[model samples]
Structure formats: C-alpha cells, structure tokens
Target: MRKEGIAKRGEKNKTTIRKILNYISKYKGMVLASVILAAISVVFTLYIPILIGQAVDQIVGPGQVNASALFVILKKILVVSLITAGVQWMKNHINNRVTYYVVEDIRTKAFNHIQVLPISYLDSHPSGDIVSRIITDTDQFSEGLLMGFTQLFTGVTTIIGTLLFMLSINPVITLVVVAVTPLSFFVARFIAGKTFTMFKCQSETRGAITALTDEMLGNLKVVKAFSHEQEAQKEFEEINERLAGYSMKATFFSSIVNPATRFVNSIVYAAVGVIGALFAVKGFITVGQLTSFLNYANQYTKPFNEISGVVTELQNSIASASRVFELIEQPALKEETGDSCVLGDAQGYVDMQHVAFSYEADKKLIEDLNLHAEPGQRIAIVGPTGCGKSTLINLLMRFYEVNSGTIKIDSMDTRKITRESLRAGFGMVLQETWLKSSTVRENIAYGKPDATEEEIIRAAKEAHCDSFIRRMPEGYDTVLGEDGGMLSQGQKQLLCIARVMLCLPPMLILDEATSSIDTRTEQKIQNAFAKMMEGRTSFIVAHRLSTIKEADVILVMKDGNIIEQGTHQELLAQNGFYTQLYNAQFAR
Candidate 1:
C-alpha cells in the first residue's frame, strides 16, 4: 500500500512536469538557444582548467620554466574564461524570459478558468484559497521554475563535460570518481522525495492561512461587533502554527540536500585524490595530467552538488505546478456553443416545471417545484431564511442550474439559450451590495458599462442617491475604495440599486433590495421600482411583507416548498402560513 501511494505520487509528479514543460515548450526556440549556449559555455569552461594544467606542465622548475609558452597558455585560459562568462550571461537572460512567460501563461489560465466555474464551485471553495492558487502558488512555482531553468542545464552539461574530459585524462581514476557519485544521488533522491510532500503541505497551509485571514479581515467589523476577536485570533494562530510547522519541515528537508550531496561528493573527491596520486606516483600519468584529472573530479562532483539543490527546487516547483494545474483543469461550467439559442427581445414570460435542485445531493433544497408567471406580473416570494427564496432567484438567474427540470424564459428552455444572452435580459439587485474601487459615476454605470453620464445621474436620482453623490468632494468622479469605502451601508445599498436602475433590463430580480435603507428612503426606492416594474416580470424576494402587499401573486414557501399562492389579500384571508408571516411583521 505504501509503495502504491509513492508510485501514484511519482506519476503525479511526472504529470506536473509534463504540463510545465508544455508551457516552456511554447518558447522552445529560446529554451533551445539557452541550452546551446550553456553547452558551449561548459565546453569553453572545461577547456580553461585544461589550459591551466598545460601552463602548469610548462613550469618544469624555477630556472627551467617555459616563460613564453606559459604566457601563451595563460592568455588562452583568459580568452576561454571570458568566452564562458559571456555565453553564461546570455543563457541566463533567455532563461529569465522563458520562466516568467510560463508563469504568466499559467496564471492567466488559472484566473480565466475561475470565471467559468459554476457558482456552486465558487460557493464551496474559499475565495482566498482560489486567489492563492492563482497568485501566490503561481508565484512560488515561478521561483522554483526560475531556479530550475537557470541552473539545471548548466549543471547537467558541466557534469557530462567533466566526465568526458576526465575519461580522456585517465579512465581508471575517472572510474573511482564515478563510483562514489551514486552516493550523492541516493542522498539527494531520498531527501527530495520526502520534501515534495512536505512542500505541498506547506503550500496548502499557506492557502488556508490566506483564506482565514481574508475571511477574518473581511468581516472584521462583524468580528468586533460580536466580540469574537479572541476566538478569531486563536483560530488564526492555530492555522499559522500549522503553517510554520509545515514550512520548517519542508525547508529543513530541502536544505539537507545541499550539505548531504556535498558530503557524499567530498568522499568522491577524496577517492579521486588518493587514486590520482597513486597513478601519478606509478608514472602512469604525469603530475600535470593528474592536476587536470583532479580538476575534472571537482568539476564533476560540483555539478552533483548544484544539481541536488536544483532538484530540491524542482520538487517544490512540481508541487506548486500541480496545484496550479488542478485549478486550471477543474471542470468549468458547461458552456454554450455558437449555435446555442440566444434570448432576443425576451417577453418576460417565465415558467418553472418539476424543478428539483439541491446544493448537496444528500440534502434537498427545492423539489418538485412548479411556477408560472405572465409578462409584467409581480411575483413576490415570501419565506423565512433557507426556504429557497433566494435560491429560486439563483435558479432563475441560472447561477445554479436545476438538478432536473426546465426553466423556460419566453417558452425557450434556459438550457438551450446562451447564458450571456439569457442573463443579459435581467437586472438584479440584492441585499448584499458590491462596489469596485471606482468613482461614484462608475459604480452607478456598472450594470450598463457604456451608459451616458446623463443616464447615470438619472439612475442615481431614481434610486434617491444623487444628493449624496453631489455632496462628495469630487461628486460623480469621487473614487471609492473596494466595496464603497466610507459609504454607509444604506448608501452602498443605494448605489447598488442605482446600478440595476441604469440597466433596467426587461426582467428584474429584487432580493431584499431595499432592506438597508431608512423606511422613508425605502418607500422612495420602492416607488421608483414600482414604476420600473410596470411592464417587466419581477421576482421580489422580500422579508418585510408590507412592501410586497401589492404583488400580483404571493408565493409563501417553507422547507423549499411553496404552500400558499394567491394575491396578498387572498393569502391573508386563507389565514395560513402567509397570514401568520404577514401579521407577525405588522404585529411587531
């Protein structure tokens, strides 16, 4: 079982490497050039030590030294060294470009994939975790990938070049150096395999910490209001402690590769030294040749040390790359093709038949539901929390697809219609307001990105937010922070209402849209919405029953099933769930 798990992990690592190589291969011409430069640089670099050895051979004794020949050899060595340096610099420059390009591609794919994922998937996962995969994990992958691209080829080429050069010098001593090199491989392999799992854990925990911090900080106001600061801190500390533990373990194990490979390599160096000395003393090879052989031994073993370090980076890279690939490869929401039906000039008709949907398969939320609404009808959905009121809006918007059933808009099945065209036909305003960091004019124009300034001000006035907008220092051009910084909750909600008013699509969905405003402002916005809803099919999910009393039909729901349906007066006369709900609100 243990062996099988390891084998699976090895296979996964290979897949990660293959995917990364595919991205790198897109710039293969540059990669090939860098590799060729690396090989050329290694060749010149290897020749320098040989030239030095020849210069050493020229020094027979102090008085017998070949001064002119020595100077010529020295000059040759200088020229080769200079050539090696220039080639390596060019190789490194190309490598940097290729590495960052690959990172950019991966990050782009990850972010694009997120946009197409189903709302269910987004709801199931933390935004911070997803953001970490796109930003932080990709960043980590790039660092490891950069290190690999920068060092891997050069280290490998030097090792092979040194080995060939040593073979030419004296094959017997070369054999001795080669014999102890396996020890370095064994050490690096054992440590690297363990570190991959550790580093992967560390990466996941970093994502968890990012998620926790995002959640805690995003709701810091709520946390302070509830006085849960200590509890939040404790939770953060627990995850942070876990992250530190994972990082320490991963770093410690990866750190071991350098020294461990060096230690094993030192033994190889010692063996080469001892054997080269014997070969020198036996007159099988000259002192100068042995000097070159020793240099080759050091060169060969040095690559093993450097490569061991690179392997550690490659392990972390593969781990991070796997995470990024998982996100990019997640099953995206099924998309509409070019031939998909488009909703053109929707008539505001909606029909839901035998609808059965659930966020989780084992737990049903909405089931066997049926509804019909004519164009221009106001259908008020009234229910307590978790009664599928907002969920019905979700289904109607196709944010969450019905598990089994048909939602027809204008008698065209929603499944057949292009999602963009279908969604474009509706304007939605929810209790939870969202505003990007932009000017007030931009916020109002969000739903209709190309709205004229006059149209924007008109929508703001309709939503009763124009007065506040004019009071700001820059008025329409005043830049707001994310989620409408410094704006009161009611003001932010008003801006969201204005955003929807700007579009005023043929169909509307108002889910507690007026819950945040003062009652006087709520009444004003309701009047504006009433005028806006004159000829559009509107689904109003409301908690304050009085606001929805004029709805053409009121559907009161409980436990995902609607039990009462009629005009508000008729439902009150029924004296059932809707009556208790309506009277309870007014009673308070």
Candidate 2:
C-alpha cells in the first residue's frame, strides 16, 4: 500500500511538472526559436571534429602535406566556431528571458491568489512557508529551467549527431559505446529516485527553519522579557540540524552520479581505442578514421555524464517546483461570479440565521446561531476567550463561510455580493494591528488611499492621536520601521483607528481595538468612537468589561452560544455572566 501511495505521488509530481511546462508554453515562440538555435549550434560543434579529421587526412595522405587545403579547412572550422558561439549566445539569451518571464507570471499569479484566499487558509499556513513558495521555490525552478534549456537540447543533439558520425567510421565501435551508455541512465535513475525524496525532505525542512526564524524574530521582545533566548535557539538549532542532514544526504546521493557515469565512460573510451586500432590494422579503416571515431566515442559518452549531472541538479529544482505547484493549485476562496451584486450605499442592517461553522470537520465550533443588528445599533459581544465572540465577527465579515446559514446585509445575501464590495462597506480595527513601513500620514490614509493631507489630519485628531504625531521630529512625514516599531503600542492602535475613521464606512467592528491604551487615552478614543457609532452600526468585542458599560446592547456568551443578552443596566440587574465579568475587573 505504501508503494502504491508513492507511485500515486510520483504521478502527481509529473502532473505538476506538466503544469509548470504549460506556464512556459505561454512563450512558445521564443522557446521554439531557442530550441532551433540550440540544434544549429550542436551541428556546428559536432562538425568540427569531422573537419579536423579531413584536415588531418589532407596533410598526411600525400607527400607535401597540402598546406593550402588544410588552411582552407582550418578557416572553415574557424567560421563554424564563430557561428556556433553566436547561436549558442543567442539561444542562452532567449532562454533566460523566457524563464524569468514565466517565473514573474507565476509569482504574480500566486500573490493574486493569496489576496483572494479565505482567511482560514492564511490562518492555517505559516507566512514564511507561503513566502518560500513565492520566492525561494520559484527561484529554484527558474535556475533549473534555465540550465535545462542551456544543456538538455544541445547535449542530446550532440550525442545523436556524434553517434551517427561514429557509425559511419566503424559500426562495431559505435555499438560498443551504445551498450555501455545505458549503464549511465540506469545509474542516474536509481540515484535520482533517492535524491528526489531527500531533496523534497530538505525543501520542507528549509521552510520549517524559515518559519521558526520569522516567528522568533517577530516576537523578540517577548522572548527577551521571558529570558527564553536559549530555548528559542535550541528550537531553531533542531530544525537547522534537520535541514543540514537532509541537504547532506541529498548532495551525497547526487554526487555519486557524475563519477559513476565517468567510470563507465572511461571503460567505453578504452574499449573504443583498442577495437578501433584493430580495425585500422586490418585496413578496414584509416588511422584518420580511427582518430575521428575515438573523438566521436568520447563526444557520445560525455553527454551522458553531462546529462546525468544535469538530471541530479534538476531533481532539486523539480522538488521545489512541486512545492510551488501545490500552493498554486490549492483551492482558493469561492469567487462571486456571473453578475454578482455590487454594494453601493450600505444600510448596515445585518442578520445571521441558523449559522453554523467549524475550523475542522470533526469538531464543530458554532451551530444554530442567530443574531440581528438594527441599523445604527451599537452591539457589543462579551465572553470568555474561546467563546466564539471573534468568530461571530469573522462570520459577519464573510471571512469564513458559514457551514449552513444565510448572512444578509441590507436585506441582500452576502454570498450574492462581491467580497471586495462587501468588505468595503465596513471598517475594522482589531487587537493585532498591522502597519507597514511608511510615513505616519500614509498609514492613516491606508483605508482611503486618496485622502488629502487635511482629511488625514482631521481623522488623526478625531482618534486622539494628533497630539503625539505633532511631537515626533518629522510629525506626519516621519518614516516608521516595520509594524510601526517606532511608536508605542497604544499609539499604533490610535493610528489604526485613524485609518478606519478616514474611510467612514457605514459599519464598524472594533475587536479590543483600545486594549493597548491606558484608561485616559481609551476614554478619549471611546468618546470619538461614540460619535462615530451614533449613525453607524458597530460591533465591539472587548475583554475589559468597563469599556462596554454603555453599549446599546450587550450579549454574554459561553461555549459558542449566547447565554444572556440585554442593555448594560438590564444585564447587571440579572446578575448573570455579564454581572460576574463586570464585577471581576473592579474586584482586582
């Protein structure tokens, strides 16, 4: 059964290779021209030895050693050599351009696909792994294809051309060379199969190391605060050691192919020399013919060695290519098609009916859920950490599809609307802030890319972040490092809130958006949010119960189900989950 599974997987890898070839097929004209040029170059190269033999015969067959005739043949060889060089250069140039273009197309496709992938997919896959597919794996594929084009066609043509030439000189010697050549193929095949498995393992281990590094470096602050550097290093070293082991094993197996083929080719060459001398002695062939035949024999077997080595390198490329193909071929989020409705002016009246969802098939998370929010209502969701509070928000944003239910925004089913338009109707501020390395002004204006300087300042002021901005050396023009590392956490949240304020969408979701701020700053931002939420439907998920005291409606939840819900005063009077949560914070 395991062997059957391995066979199926090998078939899949071949299918992936064909798909990669299809990407190359987009540049069919250029690829064909290169192949033709490669053939011409090989012919010129193979004809050189024949010219040398003829020149030798011309000089030796008669008394005076025909200097004029030999010179003419030497001139022809020089011309062919120049032409061969030019054609080879041209072929290489075209092949490289075609390879890079195909790589660029694949990278673009992968990035675009990533943009539309469901949030669940991103949640499950590591950012580093996805990045490896886009950059490292595709790059490896590019190198392989580039070298494959430069060698495979010309090498094969030289082998065939040389064989034909050798047959004309002495058939017996040609047969001997042919018989030993298959030994190289069998050896290459046997070794390549093992190298393929090792290379695949190496690629995965390399990605694992990248992921570990990304995770550790991204959280360096936490690691230091906990004094866990040694632990982090130990974890990284484990993965690094695994990667080294796989790489060494793969290279060891691949390294054996060249010398093994060379060994066989050396034997073939020795046999050709002895056998051809006998033919020459019997007067069946000339010494000149023996010389040409020996050249052809060497030429014939050299490609086998070259191809075997190329095949070994190509195993690494193919392993990487298979990884890239797996990512490209993953099922992306279902796209809205065939005249889906585009949101125009959203009213923000949302409802969930009989909603159900699960991250995994066997363990259901939310089931038979129902919720409704009137336009302009401020609905707050409060619960324990894994009680599906954020999951509810995820469902509303259509980030994950409901297992069996309908979500309607402004009385239109969300699935019927384009996700881009649907998402545009709402502005979100989450606990985990995302800010790129750019000027403060640009980060504020992210949601509304065309916002004027004045509009940007206005939003920053409204979010209570303008005071701190003015204190910075460059104010709004200051360039921030990755994730706005130059700013404090609370200040970063304020910038995020300012970004949302610029968009002024009709609906909002603030999932602990003010969690990083102190009470005074939180109060100021909350006042601004109050005004913003007055005429817009908003959902707030907060761990700090005091923040939602004035929310128009509060839903207390536990274990993926809403246990109680009412206004703050009403829920406090009931003395249930909400009462206990609110009291616990003040109790501390």
Candidate 3:
C-alpha cells in the first residue's frame, strides 16, 4: 500500500512504464534501427538451425556422405552465424546509446525542475533524500533500461520467428507448442507481480541508506564532536539491514522467474521432440524436416526464458523510474502568471502594511505586521528565538510569500515585481556562509562576477580577508574546496562578507553577519558594513544586543509583535524587553 509517486499504489508502475516509453519514443529512429538489426540477427540466427538440421541429415551413411552438398550447407551456416554476430553487436551498441540518452534527458529535466521548486518543498525534504533520487535512483533506472533495451526486442523477435518456422513443418505439434507457452507466461506474470513491490521497496531502502550516508559524511565532524559515531552507525545499520532484506527478497523472486519459465519451456520441448519423432516414424515428414522442427521448438522456447528475465529487470526499472519521475513531477514555485511589474532603480524605501503570514496555516507567526523604512535608514530588528526576525528577512527577499497584506519596495507591490529584479537590488549576508569549489577571488566576486581584479581585492581588503588571502600559496587564485575547504568558520564568513561588499546593492540585509569573527576582526567588518550601508536602507537581524547600538531605529519584538520601537538609547531608557535582553547577554 506504500506510495513512492504521485499515483495511487496500484497505478504507480503502469504510469511509470508509460512515462518511460514516452521518453524512449523520443529516439524512435535509433530504436527502430536497433529493432531492424535485431530482426535481421534473429532471422539469420533462426536460419542457422535449418542449415544445421540439413547438415545432420546429410551424414546419413557416415563415410558415404555427399561432401559437396554438406560443404555448401556448412558455408551457409558459417556466413549466417558471422552475420548474426555482427548485427547483434550493432544492435547492442544502439541500445546502449539510446538507454543512456533517455537517462540523460530524464536527469536534466529532474535537475532543472529542482531549481524552480517551492522554498517550502526544499525546506521540508532532506537534502540527502533529494540528492539520492536525482543520482542513485536515476542510475538504477538506467541499468534496468539498458537491460530492457538489450534483450527485450531480440527476445520477442526470436519467439515469433521460431514459431513461424515450426508451423511450416507440422501444424498439430506447433499448436501444442503454442498452447504450453501460456503456462510460462502465467508463471512469469505471477512471480513478476510479487517481485515489483519488493523491488520498489528495495529501491526505496537504497535511497534511505544513501541519504543516511550523505548526512553522516557531510557532518562527520559534528558526529565525532558529540561522540555520536556509534549511534549514527547503529542507525545506519538498521536502514542497511532493511535494504539487505528487500534486496534479497526481490532477487529471490526475480531469480526464480527464468528457471520457472524454463521448466514450462522444457515441457514444450519434450512435447515437440516426442511428436516430431512419431511423425518421422510414419514418414509424414522427412528426417531433416523433423530434425528442423525439433530445433525450432527449442529455439522458440528459449526466448520465454530470456523474456521472463526481461520482465524481472523491467519491474525493477519501473520501480526506480517511479521514484525519479516523482521528483520531476513535483509542483514548481508559482511563476508570474499575470503581467509582471518592473521595480527599476530601487531607492532604498520599503514598506510592509498589515502583513500576515505563517509557516503553517493553523499557526499565525506574523499577523497584521506593519513596518516602514525611509531612504538611507538602518533598521535593526532585535528579538528572541522564534520571534519572526529572520522570517521578516525572508519576506523582504520574497523567499516566502505573505499570506495576507502587501510588502512594497519603492511604493510598488513586491508581488507584482519580478522576483529576479526585486531581489537583485539587495545584498544579503546570513550567518551560515556558502562557497562553491572555486578560487578565493571567485568566491569574493560571487555577487558581481564581472568585477575587476582591483575591485575584488578592494572588497576583500574592506572585509578584512585580504591579509589571509595574500598568505596562501596561490594568494587570490587559491582554489577552495567544497564550502571553503581548509578555511576556518570565521574566514568563510569573511569571504561571504566580501561577496556582499563587492556588489554593494541599493539595500542590504545582514543577519548576524559577523558572529563567527573575533572581536577585533568583527570591528573591522562592522566598519566596512557602516561604509557600505551609508546610503542604503538596511535591515539588521542580530541576536547579539551589543552589535546594533547605533541603529537609526531599533524594533524590539516578542511573540511575533514589535512591542517597542525607538533608538537604542531610547529603548534602554524605557527599560522594557530590549533592556532585559541586553542585560541578559552581558550578565555575569
């Protein structure tokens, strides 16, 4: 009853198979080419059995054989076998190309869809889980697809071709052969039905283990620091144990399919051999024809075994594809459906009137909130944890939409403005810094990619990171690893600060921008920020009360409401929540 995709439990596999076929249809020319080659290879292969039966018949009297006729048949067999091998190789190559191309398209679309998904979707889903669907599941799907493409068409063609050849020799025996084939189908179908769910469960379990591995590896330092390594390992083993069970059950079911079909196929082979011998004894068919009929029966039954194996693999593939399509089908962030308004030349004025919002509808976090920032003012928001300070920053940047009311920038409704243009004018630095695997200079100039070397150096100097950059072996060109590898937390924070400094947008949002830096370095960064904020409207969200003493306006918030608003000294004089918080931070 478990569901991995948008469809209901019973309908998921069929829907995924149809979608996968749609993708395969995109490369019809290649698939058709592969099919043609498969057909050619099968025909040549089937003809070899006929030639083989003729050769068997020609050796009637041992040394008194017709050597010339036998040699001609042998030559035909050799030529036909060589042709079959060549064509089979070509077909395999085409199948390989088509399978990977389909996978490539699916992967590209999945990744592109991820970029436009809503913030809430990303927030709710684990990063490791998303990565597993895109990477691990996609790979599993490709393996299944490749197996399908390689065997599926050839098996079908061989079955039909061998059947036609057998029918030309004897109708009664062919009917008997055809009747027994259904048993194989029924057995394979019954086993396949049981295996799909297990394979799907196995695929899901693999993703869970991959998610755990990714989480543990990314935060290994934290695990060691907290002495939680053993706990993490235990948790991993439990998930891994489940994965093992699912895999074994799936393998067990799928493995029996070929042998089970072959068991049925053996019955068909026995019926053909015995019936053909009776016909030969009565001289109703020639010895050579009887021999060819028996060979044709064996050839015809072989594809059932192969096809059953294909069914097993396809089940696994469909399960993996279901997981992948689930990601690609997720609803994207609502785009600008109406005419989008442009916010040109932001003048550092922002207003929020009657703004009401919540992460969950039942719980109102920010209700009937109002704020106004005049041009060139420093508005520092001070609040305790969960007081909606960072949430306010998210609203300003339009990371989340307001549930009710309007937030305007430069007197234009923010909802009307294109998100790209609206957010482009504001430079933001959050406490958690992010840097890609690139050079130090590249990280500094991230916000303004085209900034000159002199400009980047000046920004780094202003942000107090230029000293460390010069000491590195490659100076500004030093290649950073993932998330500023080898750099301390403070150094990474400084690089992020330099990024915002390089752009120096019309407005700024700094949420504890200097929390990682030492006191002396923080003072230098604050001085840089002051210069940067001189003519820009800025919203500063700070937990440290000592950081925002000179703000033009201080907003003290509690339980999602701004209870006090004044200059820092005025708030202290009033002796309210702000004073109490300031005292708590400095308390011995």
Candidate 4:
C-alpha cells in the first residue's frame, strides 16, 4: 500500500510537470529567442579553445615561432569572447522576462479563480495553505524555470560540441568519457528521486508553519487571555523541527550528487590524459589535437556537474509547482449561464418553501422548513448557537447553495438571478466585522466607493461612529492596520455599520451587529438602525432578547425548525420557549 501511494504521487508529479511545460509554451516567441541567443553564445565560447589550440600549433610545430599567425589566432579569440558575452547577456535578459511574466500571469489567474471558488472549498482549507501556493510556490517555480532556460540550451550545446571535437581527435579517448558519463547520470537520478519526496514534504511543512503563525498571531488576544502562549510555542517548535528535518534530509541527498558525479568525472579525466599520451607517442594524434582534446573532455563533463548541482533546486521547484497547479485546477463555482436573470429595483420580498439543507450530506441541519417575509417587515430570528441562523443567511446571500430548496426574492427564483445582482440588493453586517487596511473614511465608504465626503460623514454620524472618527489623530483619514487592529471591537463594528448605511440597499441582514458595544452605545445604534430600517425589509439574528422585543415578528427556533413565531407580546403571552428564553436573559 505504501509503495502504491508513492507510485501514485510520482505519477501525479509527472503530470504536473507536463502541464507546466505546456503553460510555458504559450510564450513561444520569447522562448525561441532565448534558445537562439543561448546557442549563439555557446558556439562562440566553444570556438575559443579551438583558436588557442591552433595558436599553440602555429608557435611550436617544427618551425621558428610564427608570431604573426599566433597574433591572428589571439585576435580571433578576442572577437569570439566579445560576441559570446553579448549573446549571453541577451539570452539572460529574455529568459528573466519570460519567467517573471509567466509567474505573474499564473499568480493573477490563481487569485482571481479563488474569488469564485465554492465557499465550501475556502471553509475546508486553511488560508495560509492557499496563500503559500499563491506567493511562495509561484516564486519557486519561476526561479526554477529561469534557471532551466538559462542553462538548458548552453548545457546541451556545450556537451554536443565538446563530444564531436573529442571524437575527431581520437575515438578511443572519446569512448572513455562516454562510458563514464552514465555514472554521473546514475548518481543524479538516484539522489534526485529521493530529494523530490523530501522537498515536497518540506513545502507542506512550511505551509503548516505559516498556518500556525496566522492562527497564533491573528488570535493573540485570545492566546494571551487564556495564557496559552506556552502551548502555542510548543506546537510551533514541533512543526519547525519537522520542517528542519525534511530540509536537512533533502539537502543531504541532493548534495551527494555533485561530489559523486565529480568523482567519476575525475577518473575519466585521469584516464584520458594517460591514454592520450600513449597515442601521442605513437604519432596517432598530433600534439595540438591532444591539447585540444583534453580541454574539450573537461568541457564535456562540466555541464553534468552544473546540472547535478541544480537538481535539488529543480526538485523543490517541481514540488511547489505541483501544489500551485493543484490549486489552479480546483473546481471553481460554475459560471452564470447566459439566460440568468439580472435583478434590478428589488422589492425585498423573500420566501423559502419546503427548504431542506445540510452542510454535510448525512447530518441534516434544516429540514422541511418554510418561511416568508413581506416588503418592509422586520424579521427577527432568535436561535441558539448552531441552529442554522447564520446558515440561513449564507443561503440567502448565495454564499452556499441550498441542498434542496427554491429561494425566491421579489417573485424571482434566486438561482435565476446573478449572484452579484442578488447580493447587491442586501446590506449585511455580521457579528465578525471585517475591515481592510485603509483610511477610516475609505473603510466606511467601502460599500459605495464614490461616496462624497459629506455623504461619508453623514453615514458615520448615523452609525454613531463620527464621534470616534473626530477623536482620531487624522480623523477619518487615519490609516488602519490589518483588519482594523488599531481600533477597538466596538469601533470596528461601527465602521462596518457605517459602510452598510452608506449603501442604502433595499434589504438588510444584521447578525448581532451591536453585540460588542456597551448597552448605551447599543441603544444609540439601535435608534440609528430604526431610522435606516423604516421602509427596507430586514433580517435580524440576535441572542439578546431585549434587542428583538419590538420586532414586527419574532421567530423562536430550536435545532432548525421555528416552533413559534409571532409579535413579541403575543409570544410572551403564550409563556413557552420564547418566554423562557426572554426571562432567562433578565433572570440573571
């Protein structure tokens, strides 16, 4: 079973590499130019050694030293050197440009695809894992591709050019180099196969560390409150050590390839020198040819050594590329069909008829449910945790499609309306507030990017956030840290509320929007919300009973069904679950 798993992984990696190569082929023009320039450079460089050998023969071959001939040969060498330098520079420039642009395209596509990915995919995966594939893995793949482009043409050309020269001088010595070349290939392949697995593990471990860092630091307040720093540190240490181990093992194996190849090449080099001398003594080969052959033999094997050194980095690149490709290939949310309706001028009427849903297939959360809300009605949903309150909100917003149900908004099936258009009609402020790193004014005006300064101030005032904005050092212009870390929880919630207020959507959903504020501030915000909710349909999910006492209709939900729903006074008169919950909050 273990062997079969490893074999399967190897096959998958091979497929990933093929896909990456196909992706690179999209830039055929730049790639062809890079190859041509690299070929020119290698050919020019190889000509230098031949010129030197000719110069040596001119000066020392059974005649008075031919100074004129040697000088001409030296001049040719200089010209070749200059041309090789120019071609190499151009090749590297094109190679790097192609690498960066290809990586940028992949990164952009990956980021955009993730935006339309199913919400369930995001819920199941850690953010760090997704982020690692976007940033770190893409970087590794680009670096490897750049290295491959720079070296691949030169390595192949150099080997072939050197081998042909060696053969012309003497087939016997050329055979010696050829016979030993397989040893280098064997060593590289053996080590590289092992390092590939190790490097893949290292990449995964690195992502795990990133996830832990995101979790620990993002929740530092909770970690400190619970005095869990020691535990967190220990968990990080274990993950770090495991990453270190994988890295060390990969390094150890990859490092062995270089020396092993060099060892075999050295033996071949020594044998060529010995045999060439014997051939020279018998006059089977000229002294200059022997000199040239020796240089070519060294050149022939150098590419192998260079390639062996790059094997580990290439393996790491492949591992990272595999991860990135896997993410890019993930099944995204289906696109809107051509016939999908575009919602316009919503009336805020919503209905859920015989809705049955579940996050997991077998564990049904909501079943046989029916609900309705008329225009401009305040529908309050009061339920215990995990009773599908937020899930219902998710369904309404199309964050998650229902398992088996039809949700109609303003007399049109939600499935028919485009998600963007349907979501545009509703303003949502959840218990978990989200604020980007930007100025307070920008955060408040997020829902309406073109909101004027006066409009922003008015919305802030309505949400009761203007007073705090005025107290800030830069007022509304003050830049916030990530997720508005510089502000208090209540302040952040108010900014979110202000954003929603600026949009003035026809429908609103507030899931404990004021749960973090003090009672006095809550009362003020409630008054502001009352003014905002005058003619708009709204859904309120709250745990605080007092907040919903005046709601036009209250839904008493347990598990997933609404056991009772009515005006607040009518439910209280019955003295049932609603009364028990309402009295429980005040009984404290």
The digit string of per-residue lDDT tens for model 2 on 68-161 reads: 9899999999999999999999999998899899889988998888887878889998998888888888888888778787888878989988
Question: What does each candidate score in C-alpha RMSD?
Answer: 1.4, 2.0, 2.1, 1.6
Off by over 4 Å in 2: 61-64, 337-339, 471-474
List model 1 lDDT by residue over 1-588, tens digit each.
999999999999998888888898899999999999999999998997788788888988869999999999988888888888999899999999999999999898898888899998899899899988888899989999988888889999998899899988888888888888989989999999899889999889989999999998899999999999999999999999999998999999999898898888888878888888888899998888878887888888898888898899888878888888988888999878667798999999999999999999999899999999999999999999999998999999899899998999999889889899999999999899899999998888887889998999999999999999999999999999988999999999999999888998999999999988999999999899999999999999999998998999999999999899999889988999998887787876
For candidate 3, write residues 190-225 as lDDT tens digits.
898889889889988888888789889889999999
Question: Against the true structure, whose lDDT is highest?
Answer: 1
User: Higher-TM-score candidate among 2 and 3?
Assistant: 3
The list of candidate 1 runs beyond 4 A from truth reads 337-339
Global fold similarity of model 3 (TM-score)? 0.96
Each model's C-alpha lDDT? Answer: 0.90, 0.89, 0.90, 0.88
TM agreement with the true structure for every prediction: 0.97, 0.96, 0.96, 0.97
- For 1-588, candidate 4 gives per-residue lDDT tens digits of 988987997898789778877878888899999888877787787777788778778866466789998899889999899999988899899988888888888899899989989999999998988988899889888887888777767788888878877777788899988988888888998888899999899989988988889888889999999999999999999999999999999889988888898998898888888989899899997777777877887888888888776666789889998888889999998789888999998998999988888889979898877899998999999978888899889999999888887899988989899999999999999999999999998899888999999999999999999998999999998999999967999999999999999999999999999999989999999999988888899999999988988789998888888889999999989999999988888876
Off by over 4 Å in 4: 1-3, 61-64
Compare candidates 2 and 3 on lDDT and give the better one.
3
